[model samples]
Target: MLRYPAVEISKGPRTVPWGTPEVTLDVSDVESCTTTFWVRSAKKQFIHRLKRREREESEDSNEDDYVPYIPIKQRKKLKVRQAEKRLGRIGLLKEQEAGSTSEGTSEGGNEGEEDEGVNLGPKSKFSLLDQHSDLKRKAEARKETAREKILKEEEKILESVAEKKALMAVSELAKGIEYTDPIKTGWRAPGYILKKSEHEHEKVRKKYHILVEGEDKPAPLTAFREMKFPKPILHGLKKKGIQHPTPIQIQGIPAVLSGRDMIGIAFTGSGKTLVFTLPIIMFCLEQEKRLPFINNEGPYGLIICPSRELAKQTNEIIAEFCGYLEKDGFPPLRSALCIGGLPLNPQLEIIKRGVHIIVATPGRLMLMLEKKMFVLDICRYLVLDEADRMIDMGFEEDVRTIFSYFKGQRQTLLFSATMPKKIQNFARSALVKPVTVNVGRAGAASLDVIQEVEYVKQEAKIVYILECLQKTAPPVLVFAEKKQDVDAIHEYLLLKGVEAVAIHGGKDQEERTQSIDQFRKGDKDVLVATDVASKGLDFPDIKHVINYDMPEDIENYVHRIGRTGRCGKTGTATTFVNNGNDETVLLDLKHLLIEAKQKVPPFLAAKELENEKYLNIGGEAGCSYCGGLGHRIAECPKLEALQSKQVAGIGRRDYLANSSADY
Candidate 1:
């Protein structure tokens, strides 16, 4: 490096060395270096130096960049303190001068300006101590906030660890499940019925286990014959292959015959409607036989369904069933279907005609009740078909209001595939000390029906569904959330050469009926629908139930799948999922499957149910056992011993608790 003059640096104002390297600097009237220099060598050197000086000045300027300047108020205080320091020095100098002058004057006794009381300059003083105190306080506050944040992070970590441990425990317990003795089911697969038999119903009360203690009661056929039902009615039922009574008709007929308050829990397609309908028709016929009025207004029975589709279906079925009874000589059973979509005027006219059995939705029933369009005061029998679905969809209030119109101990028959707690509560409140009749397994996934749910990403849903339709080649029932989604999916399939039609709440009643009819007739192989199709639509060959969007609860899933594999047909349900959407609900579903001891998917084992080994799965919540989301423990086979430990503890606890407690 070339030798250069030593340059001194200071943070505060300080004197630069003179006479060593100062080329005259013109601060007052400085000109450009090119214009001010006289000698070329000196000018060249000066120009070079000027450039170097600029570089050096920039270097120094960056030094203070990190340190923010004090605010104007602080700067003013600093200046005031500096001024006071200067004034003190000046006063000291003046005092010395005054003493010297006095001595020189030999007692002249004249003090110059009377010393001005040693004036401290400026208006205020700056306290370095106070500034330091403020800085320390700020630092302490920042430290406290940081500490709190650390504690929260630790808490989150601890919670995550606890969840992991719990999941591991569930996983271990799942491994010991043995799957054998598979029952070969039939072609017509029905939904889950109550687990208890007539004798057992009185014993088990939890989780939808209804009991019907079958007595040596008069058979429904004997009752029909004794009541004088004609050969035409008996022949139609016989020709339709009526032998022994269905459990519902067996249990329900007697209760309704007794004219007492009753709640019957029967399986779907188990002649649930006829349980109450046959009795109502017989009773109405009996009333007609006794009264024999030319024209009378009566709503002897009210059957409530959750959906317009179900309402219409029930009405049609009842009409057919009762037609046989009518021709056999029960006063012709006139019925009106009260559901949304068809003009209410038609329903009103039918109601005005004095129908015996009114099949309606909760909302429509409430509206008819408010208009006083029908008389329900004389309604002796009340039936809530699919009562579980009604409560799930927030229709309890409306159902209760309908009940409010009817008085006197009424025979209420509640039929649902699965009974949730809410449904049980409703039965308790609405029905008198009723006989609980459970026909099959409580909360059992359909045994005869083979159920499979395919998890797919939302974005890939359309293609995945198309692939299934292409591969499976069976009548597919696709479900979407929105009416718009229904149209979109329908159009997409149509474009792909698949005959698909959309059905949703937005579709006019006729259009929905037509769409469903078209599918049923095999005119369309695939039908896209909303929750309206989730219940009470019987398509014998619905080979697949595609959930383009997952439902929020397990009950809906069960019902959706129940649409297919009906009459013993194996059905598959494909569900499209996205992150954060279906996790908890999927967990609930997995719990359902595990509780049922169904087969677990292998992917769930290696990925989902393992610690730190979760499948960003194809769907939501990591499995409770395997840490995999959107699948059951059986599906998550790989989550091993760690998960099992916690499970053993829980099992022991439950066993001890249940065994020790007195019922």
Candidate 2:
């Protein structure tokens, strides 16, 4: 023990004492005391006291309000000091433990005295290793609990899905409709009627280019007698001068009669209407013979046409065949024609009288259905004539809405001269397991038609139309792009004393009907019209079709020229082109001519060399969409417009607005 010195302390404001009045120091010897106490200066002691006061004040204040700035190097130095301090404390504890163990064995009494002065906290008995192991065990238990929770949720979801499926199956069964796999059980062709050798069927299909896609397709019948039709139906066929079935009728009729959905694609006027007409008549006749339909309960078969004129024409064909059935002592099979621009009361009266077959356009038929005028309760046979034209006329939505009203499954038949990919996709979704019957290419021009292109000036086209008509005899058809053009051409031809009659969408239903009847009866030499007459109109002995101006779309061009060459009869089509027309349409026309093996004009042929790279890329001749040889599917304008319309949320428009008047 050592005593330093006694100092007097003052409590004045300016003068403050350093410590108490007496100072005591403890040391084993004076040498150690001098070395330890003399090493620290007064200035160092004063600075350490000031730093202690600053640390205490900072901790007592709110730390969030202000943070003291520290340089990067100073911060690093402070961290190093803290680490060293921690290591030093740990080393000191280790050294004390080692010394205590060694000294306790040698001097037990002295160790006991030293242990009495030491103090241990409450957690001194717990080892760090034991605490770490306990924490890890708890974490593993939490993970196992979470995994079990997730597994239970997934199992619940699966059970619910299976339950829903079972309920749906039960509901379908209660309705007496079991939905089978369309691929497996859809084919219903009679195997006994097929030929023995498959190669014989292949040869017939190859000769006619009749491509059929589906499972278990029916073999084509070469003669009408092999179809095993009723005598009355056969007599009707004989009356119409029928000898053999066309390629479409050969494949399409069997597929439809076997209760399979079918898509029939062929050139214009290859007897497409007869394919569906005969089957519907047979269906109606069967229904009538089994049990005659009472009032408001029949119309077991329906035919949906795109245009009024086509519907009227189809109704006439059905009426003629029905007449033959009645003459042969069969039940009276009545048919009704429902279309726009006509008296609704007369149509409704015919429907109320219990017709067997109803031919209707989308606008009028949809109106009747929406107003609860009639229902397709027993109508199991459905036919869509000119399906592509209906889509172009924007009846796609109405057709879908009509489909929703059906109570049960029905045999669907779609007949069109052209089948684009979009419509084909729609058919796939709409009809279950449909058989595709294609004669030649989908949009290819009729092989029987002779295409002639002339580069007539804008001012001289009207004058040149007379010269073109002179190439063929009377009963010629003239198509123009606009109703104004149709009117102009009709006046010019009448002024020249050509006995021409005009018809367009602007005309009344009665006037249009009269004009068509006059032209069919040979009372008018030429029938001038817009595109409304270009599709699904059958005119007998039409020797020449003259296009006063080129149509906008290549598909329209194909339909326009198809009027002349029909029913395997050869005819001529003369189109007038000029520089004012679109380049894309002109290019497509040029390629169409080349594909048909017709003469290409000098102006169109000149650009063939420049587009050589784009030609023959896929080794295919024409476009699969519109049958245009000038461009591939990537650059198709029709596809682009359709996609844009879809993106803009403008689906098919109303039929009356878009297509009723052909405006």
Q: Which candidate is the best by TM-score?
A: 2
Error of 2 at 32 (Å): 92
Model 1's alpha-carbon lDDT is 0.57
lDDT of 1 by residue, 147-178 (tens): 55644553453344231211011222345332
Candidate 2's C-alpha lDDT?
A: 0.73
Q: How many residue pairs clash (N, CA or C atoms closer than 3 angstroms) in each of the candidate models, in the order given?
A: 40, 0
Whole-model lDDT values for every prediction:
0.57, 0.73
Residue range with the least summed lDDT across 10 consecutive positions in model 1: 654-663
- Give the per-residue lDDT digits (tens) of candidate 2, residues 547-603: 999986788888888997888899999999888887767878887887789988898
Best candidate, lDDT-wise? 2
Candidate 2 residues lying further than 4 Å off, grouped into runs, are 1-178, 181-192, 609-612, 615-625, 639-663
